[model samples]
Target: MRDSEKILDSWDAYSDEHTDLDGWPHDDHAYGLRASQRDADTVGAFEPLRYGARHLLATAETQLAQLPENTVQSRWVYQLGVLHAALDRLDELHEQWLVTRDALPATANPGTADFDDALAEHHAESWSYLDDWATHGKALREINTAAHKAPSALVNAPVRRTAAQK
Candidate 1:
């Protein structure tokens, strides 16, 4: 059984890494793979996040499989899976941003339709992904916090209540 705190910490770490992508200047031309499409740091940062999300998704799936359906654990697992999926989707969106950025000419003007359109699409997608991440993150945090509570307000409430009476 993975501790809820550790799981939350993993998510927090990933979120911290995600900030790197969020503030990435697609049009700055000074950061990311824009200057060097093959930049190691640019690709390296995102790869781990994707891997972490995939790992969390797999772990949640396995845990969910071992447990019964329609249970509190099942719900937690499902939420965690959704959170991981959001992270994976963010990774995909970042890749698309990279592709579009690379396709535009170095002298591409933000005022021009071609550059503006591509950049706008990437920015919009990034914002959407960020929103999903926030939503899922809040859900997971609530679930984890509830799980860590001594009373165990979940399906095991009865067990705690019975133990308390004794």
Candidate 2:
């Protein structure tokens, strides 16, 4: 098997063994998996990030769908919208990266300086999405906490009205 395949297979085994019922691994385990793949295969390493974005998108969609129509002031509704937007942007970037990677000649030399520079650029962009994702996640958690602990505060908070609502 190719090195990328082997790396992904190991990751699958580790994820299967470590993930909770929600399919989220502990932070340390996830960091370890990323560390193992970072130097080996950039494309293969991006699989987890893509999967995570998809998962969050689906979850946010579900949560938004489940909310009642009258929940205009609900913090969760707003937070889920933010989460969805962040995930969507991440997904778009991943697609662009795939197109760029696939457009490279199959016979390109991996050891060339040009190849190394391109790989570095792609890797940097890929990892940058993590910062955006984490920021959105932190915001979501804060919203959840506020919604639970001070429900009245969220209820009274002014929501941005859409043009339709205005």
Candidate 3:
């Protein structure tokens, strides 16, 4: 089966496993699992956008190369280049942080008395990285918006709303 299929299958199993509430109104263990899965799903949803950004950044590089050198247009391209560079570095750092976070063991076992402690520690580290990753992603979006508007707005100030307004 495909990777997506595998992911779906795992999700199905997880959902089934968490459906039980035991004697309580809500099963705390299962609820926590569901919440963590939701977080993972959110990150998974954005993976495609991140992948697309990488390709677009490469395209920007090629397009920037073909522009006239030492001109206003070239300056815009240079600004985009700098933004892309910083965004790329952020991506790299996020990946490294995620790798380190995921490398931590989830828990010892069902027999271990310290499972809650271990799991809490794992979540603390992983969620912190996840939050940073999300913030970095927002920065990338802001930089991209700035890049999109920079060509017409950076060197040319007092942009007119319309020909009549100018």
Candidate 4:
């Protein structure tokens, strides 16, 4: 959607209008997922992915808020919050661009293992902004490969996770 590009570009203009946000330049935050190169398929696939990741990160944050500061889960929650906030904006752009796709070849996502693999990379990338850059970075690679081997049944399938996952 050209409008979507304009929206994200507006954010860039917004940043330039102000002094660099926090310690980093507005352009710094503008990195990743350049609008011009993104294909419809990219946007189609990314919309739900960004939405899901953002939602999951928010869930982690809320759960973390309920716990004590010293626990491991809390640590993950805090760390995840930092990571999540870091990538939330990029994911938002994905959501924006992806939502523009309505008529597609399939109703279900994860249309292919390749798509899933891309998502896995994207998910892990979202977490890399926090510390443990090595851990999260590796996770991105691991999941990216694993997603490719996903069962053919998963193609065109709705996301399936255990109840505990929710």
Candidate 5:
């Protein structure tokens, strides 16, 4: 299955397990009963991204560890480059949110409508970045698949040690 299908499939299972005992009223006469939308967007988005990224990194690390001595260097370079890019996107957004929150007036902390607006703007932009990441990430995933299949041919020659290196 594709990555997003894997995510939502798992989420559906999780949602079922965490289902609330009580739910909105249902009526046979009414055709328009709508389900309540849980305001768990923060938990919903960030957590899976985190978990998936973690899974990918750990898998890449395991693959790197299993590589032949002469080839280990190259696979790690590809994996680490992608891993760091993903992390960099997340880290920048986290820092942006943290800095914005810190600079906010202490009195307007979280629940107020203005606070919600600010957060909405923050999250909206972050989601846009995520959309772009998903697009680029799909392409990178293909590159990774190729890299994994041909580590020796795929890896660039070793980088020269820097002057600062021990």
Candidate 6:
């Protein structure tokens, strides 16, 4: 099974045990408003992205660690740096979103119109951070592809003097 399917199954099992009580509605629209609110909530929306980015950063760091010191290419080093920067940006964005969300009044519950309006406002602001994260991710992917294809590209090679200079 796909990883997401497995995760969903696990989640379903857990939810069935924990949330199926108290006659909670199980229809399609039962959690629609709350889900939408989460999608719009800065902290809620970015939490998954932040989690994934953290994993990516860890994987990149592990790969870097496994490379031998003498044979490690500059491109690979650059890729690691890019991953670090991207993860840092994601963290900053998540924190900023959390602050924004926390600043809201306690009355911003999912079903209320005031909360809906707040969601609409925050959603637009959140897009800028999302766009930046996407751009960083794209750059990292491109760098990784290039490094994989040409791991010895001119970055850390020693310069040689020409005959005229010699």
Looking at model 6, the pairs that clash are none
- The runs of at least 3 residues in candidate 2 whose Cα sits more than 4 Å from the true structure, single-residue gaps closed, are 1-49, 64-78, 107-111, 126-128, 139-166
Number of the predicted model whose lDDT against the real structure is largest: 2
- Residue 127 alpha-carbon offset, candidate 3, angstroms: 4.5
Which 10 residues in a row give candidate 5 its minimum summed lDDT?
31-40
* lDDT (C-alpha) at residue 158 in model 1: 52
TM-score of candidate 2 versus the correct structure, residues matched by position: 0.41
Sort order, TM-score high to low: 1, 5, 2, 6, 3, 4
Spell out the clash pairs found in candidate 1: none
Model 4 spans with C-alpha error above 4 angstroms: 1-48, 68-70, 73-78, 92-166
Q: Candidate 5's C-alpha lDDT?
A: 0.52
Q: Over 4 Å off in model 1, which ranges?
A: 1-74, 109-113, 126-128, 151-166
> Could you give the C-alpha RMSD of every candidate to the true structure, in order shown?
12.5, 13.1, 13.1, 17.6, 11.6, 11.4
The digit string of per-residue lDDT tens for model 4 on 96-163 reads 43553332336435756555445544444332232232223233333334434444444556997899
What count of clashes does model 3 give?
0
lDDT of each: 0.52, 0.56, 0.50, 0.43, 0.52, 0.53
For residues 27-112, could you state the per-residue lDDT of candidate 1 as single tens digits? 45443322232222223333444455566456545544444343444356566766766676777877888788888998777788
Tens digits of per-residue lDDT for model 6 on 62-164?
6555444654556655655665664576566557656766776798677677666665555555544543444344444544444465445355578899999
lDDT of 3: 0.50
**Per-model TM values vs. the true structure:** 0.42, 0.41, 0.32, 0.27, 0.42, 0.39
The better-scoring model by TM-score among 2 and 3 is 2
TM-score of 5: 0.42
Error of 1 at 91 (Å): 0.3
